[model samples]
Target: MKLTIFDCDGVLVNSEEIYLAAELEFLESIGAGFERKAYMQSFMGLSPGMWEAKLQTCVEAKTGAPLPRDFYAQIDRISTVRLEADLAEIPFARQGINKIAILRCVASSTPSTRLRWKLQHVGLIDLFDPHIFSGDLVANGKPAPDLFLHAATAMNALPHECVVVEDSVNGVIAGKAAGMRVIGFTAGNHCSADHGESLLRSGADIIVENYDDLAAAIERFARPH
Candidate 1:
């Protein structure tokens, strides 16, 4: 791979658990509930704005209750407080990143400010500061390929020359659609039991259960033909 693109929340920084817990707590506060695994499966890669716009019905269907008007605000408040205090880097992710010979960057569904906060808080900012990009950079997010394509262009690499490490199905679909090889990561606390299968179904080229194996996966799966 000539370029390595990483998703932020779960792949680069270990914040998915915090995000999921905050979301579930918000749902509880609103008297709505969801089956945790099902929620992760259906909404793992959505941004906060997209979550409200796109998954409102999904949440209602899964929880058997409609979302409150304040759902987004509450979820955002809780998640911001929690992550600002507790965001941490993924174990071995930095080690694996450092071992790679290719150029690298981050392309996440997170908004730019929040993405920077988490990465800087966890001391990962220096590794990809200037190159970090958010879904807001494009007209569409994951499952549409715009964000990944934008990342590839900004990094001066073609889609076929990039490898994406992602922890969610939408991300895998986006990477594949952008013509990059994707490695599905199940190392996050929020990963469902069937996460790997879901990502594979969405077009991941490889599945990695831990950051320790990410470098090898990139080598094996993202090679030029």
Candidate 2:
């Protein structure tokens, strides 16, 4: 059976905007002056470790100073409160996922602990459960093939038999690099006007705008005529 690898944040949960808002607020308060467009385009799909490193680099380059003490802790506090208040599943995601009969698991840049928490909060944890894999499990994350390849191996599926459902350019690139067919999902609020084009440029085989179309897309790849 084919396997479906789902990306957590933007693809399954509508939490990117919450994270973006909290980060933007914190950065602005710290005088980082990070632009929204620049941050989204450059950092959307990176793992937490990579994001902090890159963000700190950008902050220092802009302000000639490293991030303030407890920067991430503060952002976490803000994001947690906001997420508790606003976190929700992507529209029709649960319904769409239920329609997929093939083996499926979540492969995300989020650390395992938080990934499970978010999925549980949004009622998606039961859908993937122990099969969920995180970037923290590997040495490399999105934009590299490591996490996807690891997930494929763990699921006992070949790279070519796995289909990646992602919502970011980095993820699409990673999936293609892992020799998997990638479906770029753009229904997340974080997606900009050119988001789909960017994913295509990054090597996504198809673009799916909403969960309403996702089941059909996955079926096409999993059981081709």
Best by lDDT: 2
Candidate 2 structure quality by residue, lDDT tens digits, 1-225: 389999999999989989998999889888887777778778888999999899989999989998888999999999999999999999889999998889999999999888999999999999998999999999998889999999999999999899999998888989999999999999999888888988898899899999889889988886655
Residue 222 CA displacement from its true place in model 1, Å: 4.9
Candidate 1 lDDT over 1-225, as tens digits, reads 799999998988878899889888777666666778777766777766676776687767767777777777777888888887888888877787888778999999999988998888988899897999997898877777898899999999999889998998778888888999888999887777788998898898878998777777788755546
- Which parts of model 1 are misplaced by more than 4 Å? 59-66, 222-225
TM, every model: 0.92, 0.95
Estimate the overall C-alpha local distance difference test score of candidate 1: 0.84
Candidate 2: lDDT over CA atoms? 0.91
- The clash count for each model shown is 0, 0
Residue 141, candidate 1: how far off, in angstroms? 1.1
Candidate 2 is scored at a TM of: 0.95
